[model samples]
Target: MTPFIELFTPVSIRGMTVKNRVVMPSMLTHMASVNGEVTDRLAAYYAERAKGGAGLIFPEATAVDDSGLSYFRGLSIAHDRYVPGLKKLARAIHEHGSRAGIQLGHGGRYAQPEFSRSARRLVSYLPGISPEEDARVMDKEEIERLAGCFVQAAERAAQAGFDMVEIHGAHGYLIGSFLSPFTNRRTDEWGGSFENRMRFAEVVIRGIRRRLGPDFPLSFRLSSDEFLPGGITVDLAAKIAAYVVHCGVDLVHVSAGMIDTNRFTGPPPVLPMGWNADNAAVIRKALEGTNALVTVAGRIHDGDTAERILREGKADLVSIGRALIADPWLPHKLETGQLKKITPCLSCNEGCVGSIGKNRPLSCAVNPRVGFEQRPARHVENARKVVIVGAGVAGMEAALTAARLGHAITLLEKDSRLGGLVNIAALPPHKDIFLRLIDHMSHELVENGVKLVLGNAVSAADLKAMAPDVIIVATGSRPVIPGFLKNSSAMTAADVLSGCPTGQKTLVLGGGLVGAETAEFLAAQGKEVAVLEMRDEIAPDMQGRARAFLMEELSARHVKLMTGLEVRSVDGNGVVIVKDRYGNEYPLPRYDTLVAAMGYRSEQSLCAELTREGMRFVAIGDCVKADKIMAAVHQGYHAAKAI
Candidate 1:
């Protein structure tokens, strides 16, 4: 039996019906036509999503007029001249069994200064609202032109074979100005009273209905709650929804907090998850029993959670933006009950969030083939005897990726088990999220048919004897020490994390993430702990939010951290240290347990020997350089592709 997914069911609004509940909503792709027509690249990009199994493809907000363009060259639907290209786009989506829709947007006063019609844009024509503050103001005559532009755009959508059309009313856009009281404070008919403020959106909806008639479905996306102090509330959004549904909208798509309000509209919950679904429930509860369907989005990962939401009737459909981007084949994989085979969304935000903001292509950190569907899948040049010498994150990723390319792979490990060192790195009190990647990649190696020789011993001679076409040496690295063996009593960060053996009063030696985190873990276990680093600050390389949170936790837990302290020597007594940032030798804290996380050194003996032999080989992951898992996984992916 197929596992249930609320996100997998079909949705029909008006005459338009989609195959699945998954809707790839409009996202601003900086790709556009030079003269505001749909370019082939833009067409191919959306087609990739359609082929990946999206039931509906809403192309990025296309400007209805030249003045409405937000980017250098955005897709436009204002002119009849653009219909041929739009028709081709609709045809491409229909070929994949997905209904195509285009969003009709007018930048209005929200148009950027670089793209503004003049230095001033209309914020609102009403008193107390200035056009320059938000956008160029629309005069009475200008409003008629803009309304006509939308009507003509709807006619164009019908001609282009688009099944439905959505008016861009959310995210502080053109119609948004008329909906938001903060932006629209006019006493006129188009502003002031809630009913009056909604007039512009109502007019735009009426214009779309007039152009497409009642049979064609039309949906309106709402901000739900603006998230700002003075913005609209849930009760108000529901009232607006009821009013609009009566005005002829077919669906109510609920999304919370956009660029202007929350400023963090990532497709998924970036780290701490489940914020979006709560907001979705609120919007859905308000619109319960209306003929109009309710849809919600934001970080809806894992098929089970999505299915439960649908089964419980919390939402009619769940918009999975990042999950779909990560694996376009997610729906097909779920239907076939190949759950384990599905590449889980790591929620790293490396590909989806970073790519969208940087104006680069979309992709996923766990899945390397993301966003490059246009490029042919990377395959092995020929079946070659390949020997992998480590089984950590880097080693495993490289082996599995290469194995999938049809290479004969033999993974060798010296230790009795796999996960060299990383098993220790995974023990942090707050590193649960990072640790999950280790599990994911390890599973991938076995499922992809890579041969695991865990206990086997392999030297350089054994590698040559195997006559491998290529050798990827991932022997990893050794912890950095001021003096090796002499400081044997001082455990490395790796050993301390594993908790194999340690004393009660522990002094961690490094203020970076590893040392700080180890101190946290040990302290939480009721072991008195202090951290000493030669640098003035800790977690300097950490991201802003995580660094702030870790710092707060360290302070609250009373984990003593001493920076700019230089260590002397270690003996049975403990670590002898000094305050040497300015060369002063003041005595630092001494302890019963001294943990050294000064860092790691490359295990280059095997890598060096293999490189010197003039052999066809690749040295990747920590074996090349010791760093975070992101680097390790990234290098492993590229290295395997290169082979």
Candidate 2:
């Protein structure tokens, strides 16, 4: 029997039958051509997940009209010229034994001005926020035209052999904006009353149904709660779900939060698993008598949780988004009882969501081969003896990759434990999910027969004696201790996170990710903490949902955050002196502990030593340059492949 029996069970939505309950919801990949044409890379990306055994796959959101293009490389169904490429994409999924679905959307007030024909396809007037808000309200005729765009897009999807098409009505897009009371501030027939506010979505749904006929499956994505004062709440969302089902929607994809409340979208681990299950239950109940199926997705990472969601009748299906990016073979693993082999999604958002937000190709921290699915890792004809120093993400990944390619791999770490910096990183509040990644890698290394030599520092003599064909230096990095704190009794952020004792009132002297996280960790332990940074904003390096959630956590804990203040020196009484940007010095409040989290410096001594010995070695991760985990993992993967 399958491990996650309910999750692996086949399910049908409308007339379309899926192999299993696992559905891959649409996520932006930015792999399309600049002209909105599907590229081979995009096709390969979707094909991979489909091949990995996802029952149903939705490849990102596609634009219905040129005026609604949000991403620079987003797919478009506005013209017939795009049909050939789309047909190829659908065929790729079909060949992989998965049903293909495409999500149709119009960005409206959220469309980027640079990529769109017009930046103002809003439902109503929303003041200056971005170029998306500078718009004229759509007239009755304009509304009809927008509905026609949806109809045509659905027609094109059917023509391209797609199994189904999902209407992207969530996340503050064109249709969602109209359905939301927070943005649909209108008195016309298209807004105001409940029925009026839902008119636009109804129009799009009915138009697509009419064009595609009743047989073609249609799914409507909705935000069960926009998380605003007067926005779409659970009550309103249930009603809306029922209404859409009545209008011929075959499935209701339940999601929560909008662009404004984006911290809930692709949420970090700070949030509970299956965070949107309750909202989905409400919507599912609302559509109880209807034929429409319901799917819930929001941080639903594991197969066990997905099975429970199905067993409890919260949703007819489960949509795995970011987790699939981390490991596309999750469904296959569950079915084959290879639970331990499945790589866990850290939900760090530093890779997939964060990278996509910055208009870059989507990548995953745990899995580096995200966009380059076309190029699979192949075993080399000649297997070399590979020695890796450092058992962090970088070295571990390198050893795993090389061992998989039939190389004799030995991973050495100075510390007794695996996951060098990752051990300390996972110590922060709500960040324990990171440990799952290291745990998975460690298991893989052992399973693949890679020799693990922990608590052993490899010296020059040791390397020469081993006489390895290739060496990967992944020494990682060390925390930067401020000049003033060098001689003082201040602790490093790593030291504190690694279980070093902290005082009653601790002062953290950096407002970056490390500092802010350290402050939260301390405050959670009932210790009073304050953070000071030279920059105006805290956690500048961090962005999107992670930073938003961190800020909220910091505020709730009453952690004092001071910015734009540089450390000057330590006074005679041991009180730390800080100076504002204006050069005015001030003595800080008394604190028992001061942690220096200024940043990190690369530990490149091993690389220098190798060069001095006239030995060649590939240095990856922080040993080359101190950066985020994504960079280190990616470098390790590619460096091993190169060897």
Q: Which candidate is the best by TM-score?
A: 2
The 0-to-1 C-alpha lDDT of every candidate, in the order given, reads 0.73, 0.89
Instruction: Please list the residue runs of candidate 1 whose C-alpha ends up more than 4 Å from where it truly belongs after superposition.
Output: 5-7, 28-45, 65-82, 106-152, 172-193, 232-236, 260-264, 267-274, 378-381, 414-440, 455-458, 475-603, 625-631
Give the poorly placed runs of model 2, Cα more than 4 Å off.
Answer: 128-134
Model 1, range 1-643, lDDT digits (tens) per residue?
Answer: 6666456667777756788887777876555665677766677777777877778878878888767766555678877899999998898788888889888887766565555344333646545444435355667787778778888898999999998888887777777777887677667777778888888788888988887777989888877777677777677777878788878987777766545543335522223443456666666676666667877766576677678767877677777666676667776777677666666665546655555555565545666665455565566567777788888777887888888888888888877767777677657764555555566666777877888887776767778888877788888888888773364687788777765677778888888877887888888788888888888898775543345556767888888878877876554566474657777775555677778877778888887776677666788778788876656766777787777
lDDT for 246 in candidate 2 is 92
Q: lDDT of model 2 at residue 410?
A: 92
- Local accuracy of candidate 2 as per-residue lDDT tens digits, 377-445: 888899999999999999999999889888999999999989989888899988898888888999999
Q: Candidate 2: how large is its RMSD? A: 1.4
Return the TM-score for candidate 2, rounded to 2 decimals.
0.98
